[model samples]
Target: MKFALNSNLRPLQMALLGSMTVVAVGFAGSAMAENRVTYKSAKAGTSYYQMGVELAQAMKEGTNGDVIVTLEESQGSVQNVMEAPSRKGNYVFTTPPSLVAAAENSKGAFEKKPDEKYKEIRALFPIPSLTMHFVTREDAGIKSFEDMAGKNILVGKGTFSANEGTKYLNLFGLDGKVNLANVELNNAVPALKNKQIDAFVTAGSFPSPNVIEAAASLPIHVLSMSDDQVKQTGAARAVIPANTYNGQTEEIVTTSLPVIAYTTTEMDDGTAYTLTKTFWEQRDKMAGNAPWWNGVTPEMLMNVSGKMHPGALKYYAEKGIEVPATAK
Candidate 1:
């Protein structure tokens, strides 16, 4: 076969080739990077969810949408840390007891060895919760933990409150005396009002919303933490002064649970660094959504306990903040 092309054919071929290349580039641009990270927590409607949304919004605005964060709620604090970096979420917000347990070389707790998977986790921040308050009727004559030794106590398994409080209970030899009931707070609260359970042990923010609501209808007293008790547990605690919450004119003293909010070390350092930087830089936007993030500062992030990635260390140093004392 013989083929003949007119001189006009050369320019048309070049234009067609250019059009194909341009279309290819456009499609690649539209694919978008899959850099979204998930954050998980338990306790529906708790402050952690609010904090997570704030963080996600900060990520979007900071990178001009290059990175994103999503929240997965209602997983127990312990579960949040374990499954986060691997499956549902990359970030875990929970109490330190659980994170410390996750670090344990315990069998069957983590899917992979500490070096392979556990090392992926890092402590990003501390939320700082308070101890499980043991609230009894004021006239019950129970002014301190010593008084509740032989009474009914409420607890749920796997709660940080249960784990830590049990240790102290044993130390004082009250573990055998208290009639331990494995029940939810809701079920136990009503019973306490009816003289069923002497006191309920629960870990929550000071002026527990449940305790506050219960007090509006009935009278109750939150047991005070003795200096000896605080020293024994060795966990950071705070006091809920009298009138800290509505309905109680007198101080409702309690101790802090002291928790940490963490992320997995498994994520690429660049991803971790960007997240750490963007969250702090755009913290005002985050604080708008969840006032809980309000107290955080750039200097605060530099002082966290767990391992920090090299990239995160670099960003902190550039901001005139020193690297964490133990950063590698």
Candidate 2:
């Protein structure tokens, strides 16, 4: 082993090895930050859309723009989940276990047929629970779902929120009797203020922006759903604490569901892991801008529909969180 190295060969070998190291590191870095991705949320001005915007910004900041997320406004939860897996790297926001269950089985609003893509959607994180808001004017004389028979009612437009409204109407046996109006959340406010509709139903995280705005302008009453009503309707029980909004004194017992972020299973593990980590790291920052993000916890991230992204699972496991067995 006492051989002398060739003067010329040593420099060449050193340069070659250095170049290989640089190339390997470059490829790994590139893989860490894939190209831009589209994040689908409910129509603009909705809580989903707001969350999408903050998520996109947080992901960008965390990755230093490596993972660029574009906010894509979608129709609603059912539509968002249905359309989410249409493209790779596209993500969606869904509330309540019901919507995800419906999308996964192609039931309820998704009753056209079974979609294989639905099975491939994976949960990423839980943002907030969507609170149902049954809006009516103080003078509408509508005390409950029973009182809305034969009156014009505004359900949400092209979102799972709207589907839930219709389900409630049907559950109360007022489906055919009431004049159902499918309109956007913002537009529904005017219809209610102008007396164009007798009652309107909308939903989002507590302090629903539209509901707050509507209540500020008119003598609005957010009707309550009894525990029995929610149980009968198959909606998760929720309570809107008194004074959550101006003029709202009494607590509103209603149904609600957690909103989860999801992505297609086809996303690379590295990208998924990076995105998930970035979201967790910047969550406090995101919540500072959007209060709806304040209540996230390890428990909230568990018990989601469909499988969990392996990347996300790895992160959760590191945090000592329990993922559902089915999802794992």
Candidate 3:
């Protein structure tokens, strides 16, 4: 048998051969690249989610598009802390330090039994301080936390907001005196308008969407906390900033807790180091998207109460930034 190829067929053969070569190269490049890590964040539009999107984009850019990251929506800080440590996969999460401490100690929100796996969790970075907002109707005449006595309030339905609200009530000796209306945040504004609830408490990044919406429709006031009480709760003093809401002229004095990014101890040093370095180097790019990402210095990221991921520590050390003794 003889095979004859016309001159016109030669070009087609070469083009097909070139296409195959390109596909082979592409596959080889994909195989050599690092696996994409899953980044867990809160619901869309929330500060956590916004920051997560920014960080993932920055990581992808810093890694020359080799280290891909995908975001998974979650139940925000409290639940994220409880589940992230035990979840299997190349994953990172955001949660408050108080919840991290709770998960480690197995008390407070976690009950008396601590989740031992939580001890394996390592700090990556602290995104921002989540300030507590106690919003009430201006007509309610609730001038302070103590004035919440005998008034119905919504602290969120089985959320971290509720947990913290209870803590605040107890701290101010208004626990039994205040009537907590077990209701979700979505119901807060309606309940307030109907005069069913006197106030609602939410803790998150400044200008909370729910609070803003409620303020637009009603006369709202954000209560302040005393410095001594903030210290007792281990919360940093923060301000809501003037004009965060309508009629909010003066900065509202409040307390805040740090929201941190974390990973499990099983994440290898090289990957962790690269991720930490990539995030740190690309932070300026992410700052414009979310107020929470602003001014996130390496020192703040390393100010965690417990030990940090060795990879993160290594990256900071390379930058000549000293890690805090408590976070070692």
Task: Give the winner by lDDT.
Answer: 3
lDDT of each: 0.63, 0.78, 0.80
**Better model by lDDT, 1 or 3?**
3
Model 3 Cα lDDT, one tens digit per residue, 1-328: 1345557587899999999999999999887686578888799877668777888889888999878889989976776777765687567888777777778887777885566788888887777667789999999999898889899988876666777877888888886898889777878888887888999988877767778888898998999888887876766777777887899998888877677788888778888888888887887777666555664666565447667899888888888887778777
Among all windows of 10 consecutive residues in model 3, the one with the lowest summed lDDT is: 1-10
Name the lDDT of candidate 3: 0.80
Summed backbone clashes in each candidate are 15, 0, 1
* Per-model C-alpha RMSD: 4.5, 4.8, 5.0
Predict model 1's lDDT versus the native: 0.63
Off by over 4 Å in 2: 1-35, 76-86, 89-118, 141-143, 146-152, 156-159, 173-186, 295-297
Per-residue lDDT of model 1, residues 1-328, tens digit only = 1234655587898899999999988877765554777666656676556556666677788988878676777666556655644653345455454454555443345535453465555665444354467667665777777787777777656766677667767766686877786677666668777777777777775545667665764677777776777777776545666675455566555456555566665556677678767766787765565444444545444435556656566677677776467644
Tens digit of per-residue lDDT, candidate 2, span 52-129: 888888988898888888887776666676675576554545545566788788788778856877888888888778
User: Higher-lDDT candidate among 1 and 2?
Assistant: 2
